[model samples]
Target: MDLYFMGTNAGVPSLERNVTSLALRLLDERRSFWLFDCGEGTQHQILRSPLKLSKLENVFITHLHGDHLFGLPGLISSRAYQGGDTPLTIYGPQGLKRYITTVLELSESRINYKMDIVEHDGGTVFEDESFRVEAALLDHRIPSYGYRIIEKDQPGKLDTALLKKYGISPGPLYGKLKRGESVQAPNDKTVHAAEVLGKSKKGRIVTILGDTRPCPAALELAKDADVLVHESTFLHELAGIAHTYHHSTARQAAEAAKYAGVKELFLTHFSSRYKNNEQMDRIQQEAEAIFKDTTLAVEHVLYPVDR
Candidate 1:
């Protein structure tokens, strides 16, 4: 699992950064890729990365803010042009269906792939065999939400030495044993899979928050996450402005990560005022003062999440 930042700017696009779009790459896993918040010019950002628009299977919108969702119509239409025939599912708060439909209608765009929209009311929203996604209401100017993605734990590798010790040869029976099945041997003896398998490995947890102020819901959603991606729209000195705009400062984001027990914290959604890399470095330094694992997010940067 990996997270690729396609856009990191907060409200508007700047020469240094784009708007708020992120791609959760699940290569070598069950899913291919899931996108979060397709901001304006997001497809243009994807053109610079190694991502394929045809592989985008799922999208989660945080809010209806233009910076968060303006790129939806273009991306959906472009995917069809790129020969994306697979079904795409989008989850967001209420009114997303009408918004998307209006865009499609106004643009007169026709997609070859099937699109499914699911409007959620902020709790545990989606669950599959491989992963589960939960959402919570955030303290934003608009009706926003934060999402927590939990990958399911998988069984560990079998102890081949133990299997061989029990006179079990490498064949389909090994597959059965790895699957935790008890089978009868040639000598009428029962061999249990649990006796030869190693302990199960824990899955990774990724928490991503939309634009919001310091809120309990955000902290709860990010609890014990392996990776926490939070918006930091201002410097710590601009706490008053951050509070007024329903956004978080760099220090506030780090504090949330520390409280949530997250292993790593990525701060994005930067204001365009900070044009130089030095300013971003200073913000990251401030965040790191509060949380050691805190870092600033840059466009196209990918962070791997290992299970």
Candidate 2:
């Protein structure tokens, strides 16, 4: 899977970056994309990138802040205009449905597709054969949430060479062996699947956090994640200000990633105050001091999460 940063700035849009928005591209896995946040002017950002609004299957709003959700109506309308007939589901906190519907109604926007809203309290919000999404309440000013996306383990490939040794040619029998089912040989001998298949592939874990201060829930959700996407709205020196605003500093975000034992930590939701690369590097340096695998999110950049 890959994560594309559409907008990485916090609160407002700057010349260098827009507000909070990220697209988890799952074209190879699910043939669609899952959007994390739709900040204002997010649609415009997508236009400048390789992302497609029609490929978006779900939108997960982190909080009810205007900067985090103001572009929902516009995006939905544009998706309809682009001939996206497939249904879309949005998962978020309470009042999300009202917010989207109200804006659509007031603007007289007509959508040709179905839309479903899910307001989850906590725990597993969505589950299927391939993946499961769990939500946890974050320590933000509002009822913000963080999502832990767990991909189910995949079965290993069949050992063609081993099967050939058993006088089995590649065909329907290989499919059965790959499914861990015992198949009968041409001589009526029972062939066990385990002896002909490789080890199962481990699943990938990704945790995306909303605006929040360092808290236990964040750490719990981020544990053992392949990628931990946390907000770093301030530097280490301005940690007190970050606490006052209920946001995290680079150091605090790094602390969470280190405690959680994540493989990679991506710091996003940059405060607009850091305008130049020098200022941004300082924030990244703070996080790297604690967690060496830390990266600062840049707009239009795609970060891959591979197992």
Candidate 3:
């Protein structure tokens, strides 16, 4: 799995960064992509990347903030125009359904595909054989949320050499073996799948949070995650401002990553104050002081979520 940060700025668009939107590309795992936020100008940002809006399946909105959701109607409309026929699902707070419905109705936008809008009140929002997603209410000015995506453990590859040694030719039976099923050969020989399979591969965990103060829910959502994407909207000197705005400082984001014991931490939702690369480097350095693995999320950069 990979994470592509479409827009990384905190509130408004700056010369260097846009608002808040992230695409979680699951091509290798699910053959589709899941969006975190669709900030204003988000479609423009995606136009510059390798991502295809046609392959988008789900959008998770953190709150009803304009900066985080203004692009929804435009994207949904564009998806229909771009020949996106597959169904799409959106999960967010209570007002999400009304917001999306109102905009689509007012704009007279008719999407060809089915749109499922889930207004969540926390807990598990989605689950399938491959992944499970849970949401937690975060401490913010509005009813913002944090999501934890857990990928299911996959079965290891089947031992081809072992099958060959048993004089078994590869076929549909190999698939059953890989799934840890026992099969009987035509000669009445019972082949145990587990005996010819390698160890199972562990799944990856990723946590993405919306704008919020340092809260217990953030830590719980990020616990033991492979990568935690949290907002660092301000620097240490302006921590008071961050608190007053119900936002997080660079140090506060790192502290949450450290407490959760995440393998890597990506700090995003940068304040507009950090304009140039040098200024952005300062935010990374300050966060590194607390969690050494912290990294700043550069727009359009694809980060690998490895196990």
Query: Which of the numbered candidates is closest to the native, going by highest TM-score?
Result: 3
lDDT scores for all predictions? 0.91, 0.92, 0.92
| TM-scores for every candidate against the unseen true structure | 0.94, 0.95, 0.96
Which segments of model 1 are wrong by more than 4 Å? 160-179
lDDT of 1 at 179: 80
- Tell me the lDDT of model 1 at 185: 72
Better of 1 and 3 by TM-score: 3
Indicate the worst ten consecutive residues by lDDT in candidate 1. 298-307
Error of 2 at 23 (Å): 0.6
Q: Write the per-residue lDDT of candidate 2 for residues 34-63, one digit (tens) a residue.
A: 999999998988889888888889999989
Quote the lDDT for 304 in model 3.
Answer: 91
Candidate 2 clashes between residue pairs 3 or more apart in a chain or in different chains: none
Displacement of residue 225 (Cα, Å) in model 3 is: 0.6
Model 1 scores a TM of: 0.94
Q: Which digits, one per residue and each the tens of the lDDT, describe model 3 over residues 1-307?
A: 9999999998899988899999999999988999999999998888898888889999999998999999999999999777689999999999999999999999898889999999999999999989999999999999999999999999988888878877677899888887789987666788998788899999999999999999999999999999999999999899999999999999999999999999999999999988987988889999998899988998888899878
Off by over 4 Å in 3: 164-172
lDDT of 1 by residue, 149-268 (tens): 999887788888877777788899988887889977777689987888889889899999999999999999999999999999999899999999999999999999999999999999
Candidate 1: RMSD to truth: 1.8
